[model samples]
Target: MDSDEKDSIKNESIEEEVEEVEPARKKKKVSREDDHEYTVFIKNLSFDTTNEDLKECFKKFGKINYALIVRDNVSGHSRGTGFVQFEKKESVEICLNQAGKIVLQDFTLDLMPALPKGKVKQIEKEKEAKKVEPKDSRNLYLLREGMIMAGSTASEGVSATDMAKRLRLEQLKSSMLKNLTRFISRDRLTIHNLPDSYDDAKLRKMVVAKTGSKPIECRVMRENKPTPTHPKGKSKGFGFLSFSRHEDALAVLRKLNNNPEIFSANHRPIVSFSIEDMNVLKIKERREIRSKLNNPTYQEKLKIKKLKRKENRKNKSENKPAIKGTRKAPKQVEENEDAFSGFASKPGSVPKHRGTFKLKEQSKIHEKSMKTQNKLRRRQKHELEVQQEKQEKKFDRSVKKSKISDKDSLVAKINKYKDLLKGSNDESTKKQKSKKWYVD
Candidate 1:
């Protein structure tokens, strides 16, 4: 072949190689950049999720580049949706394969490719716009639009479309009403002094019979442990019952209050019922019941006084002073009439003196007992100090013994090394002298 032709052919071949290699290089760079851009949408997340939770959940698939949970702006609760990005394509595929296979808190996870960022932002904006309208206005608007979509007005007869729309609207209204009514109708009935063996089901049934509806829920009050009462650990003998309807709750309250059999003779039935909106009643009842239970009554005070008087009589009889009766002469009385008359007091007068004296003696005895208690306390304090000192001394002695033993072992090791070195040197000297004689 000619040289010019060969050179032309070589140039063409080089160009072809360059074209082929450049496209591949570009493709590899593109792929590497796209790897980090891949994101997965995770659903059924917990409402209380944090960024750390999202990272931990996606960490099993691959190195999580970033993670975030969508949150409500006002409520600050997670919206149960989030995104996780990975730096590897294989990780994305693996996550999708196990999408619904993973479960968290009884909810299955749903993983899919994240939608475009524009679409997500658009959806969030729409949601925010919807939320900005007042709730009542929003509901009325929905109702009106729904009716229009149904091809009928509230007064006009419903068309076939209207019937379908009405059904849908009714369902929505029912759900909304159910949620709204929960806060309005139910009342918390706190029945105190309930028998320990009282059956919750039976009580609910009884309440239902009286109110025409079963209680929505019921729970037994936990015993004292600082629960709304004194004598911590004592169950106030009561529990709470939440009714499904307010009328039913009020009816139950009326019947329970009027029934005499419900309360013991000494203790009246203390049935307090209040709507959830009126939480102040719970606080008030707690204070009132605590005060009534702790305070003493008028009858109790009188009984205590009688008991104290009886105790006094018993103590006086035990420590009665002996009195010897004596007769006074009339002539001596006449000689010092005024002085003698005062001395010749009636027996009753002497009894009063004896009572006063006995009271003073009792007071003195009580004071002596108090002093004896003080001395006993001092003695106990001295004994405790002595015991503590003895324990400290014993602890110190053990510490010193351990230190002394450690020192002795170190000294013994040093002395043994010195003796070995001296013995070895002496032996070496003797061997050297004997070797010199042999050589000569």
Candidate 2:
């Protein structure tokens, strides 16, 4: 009676133990991420939109747990996006089902589930950490197969299959590692703060001078077309320099980086193994500059520049010599042959004066100067015409105001100017008609 009872009780106990263990084991494989409630991301916000407005808009679906408009970390202005937290999961689903069509501040919104503030950064960190966690399957397999047995040699009867596989893996890993380095890097030089006059030829010359070997490729960053401010495709302040040999690139970096005279004092030079780091640095730099655009110091500097430009323009106009329409041409001036030493003044040929080379040697320089002067004159003429137009409009506005107020003097002055302009136009037309050489 005792043996039978003992056996039956033991069997029941073992069955119950197995059932409990099975559920526990299965729990490890299960993930409950879908159940996680989250804040809803709302995109396409207007700059003037406030947190209060967003919260009010989100309140119709359900009780808002929290709501916030994402703002620039440095400037404290809206980044044109926001998040709304809901108390219930049903509300988030309803918002998603709306297809992000909530019109707030005249913009149809785009919506998605919002992640926690550092979730993205944390995930990136995890991915990086995972890479360094010894994930080599071959290594794991070798260790498990006792292929890494200590004090073993070829004569010790180690499996030929295991040895061959191990050697093959080692060779493959080495080759891959070498190729990986190549894929991630290129010999690059970062030229920053390029001069306004920097060109591809000059850049190549400089690179050759510093490195003693010519770069495989050289480029001076330039705009594709002229802008309102820059009438030429000017240097964009930075460029990439590449070399076939990395050593030469390193030489350039050591020679030119921060040596202001060669690369221009304004733009610094940097040598890099890869252009990626340079690009990343540029991005960060641009972000910092953008963040500081609203800064008082930067604004003051801009105002100072504007004032300086105005002053320079004023001084230039005031100091300019009057143009003489009948001035003698330089080529028509006759000179004696004995007037200069070590040079002869020949007819129909440019002659260089003693210790001074002038007029024709640097035609490009002269051309650039002429172009600049022409541009300045055109700009001044335009500005003057604008000023005149503004004055006329102001006078007309005053005349209208005077007529409304029954002031006769201002109306008379406006009429007098209008009559003068009309008379000038009539005279010019009459002159054109009288001239025999007038073009139709």
- Per-model TM against the reference: 0.22, 0.25
Q: Judge candidate 2 against the unseen true structure and give its global Cα lDDT, from 0 to 1.
A: 0.59
Write out the backbone clash pairs for model 2: 193-267
lDDT for each candidate structure: 0.57, 0.59
Candidate 1 local lDDT, residue 160:
31
What does the lDDT read for residue 322 in candidate 2? 85
Error of 2 at 186 (Å): 13
- Candidate 1 per-residue lDDT, tens place, 1-440, comes to 99999999999999999876454234334433344347788888888777776778678989866677788899878899987778777889888989779776677888888766567799999998777433341122112111111111221222233233324433444444343322222355666546655556766766666546677777666563654433344444667878655445544554553233444432333344422323555789999888866877955876899999999999988887688447674332122121101122211211211133433443444445546666898999999999999999999999999999999999999988997776744877668756755544
Worst 10 contiguous positions by lDDT, candidate 1: 333-342
The C-alpha RMSD in Å for every predicted model, in order, reads 39.0, 38.3
The sequence of per-residue lDDT tens digits that candidate 2 reaches over residues 1-440 is 79999999999999899876454234324434542364688888999997778988888889875677888989999999987777788999998899657898789999988765468689989898777434332221211111122122211222233233333433433344343222223366555556677788888887777647787778877888988766668788667788765455545555554444564333344333332333565789999899789677988888999999999999988987888457675333222121110111122222111111221223334345446666898999999999999999999999899787776777877888997776754777678657787557
Looking at model 1, how many pairs of residues clash?
A: 5
Worst 10 residues of 2 by lDDT: 336-345
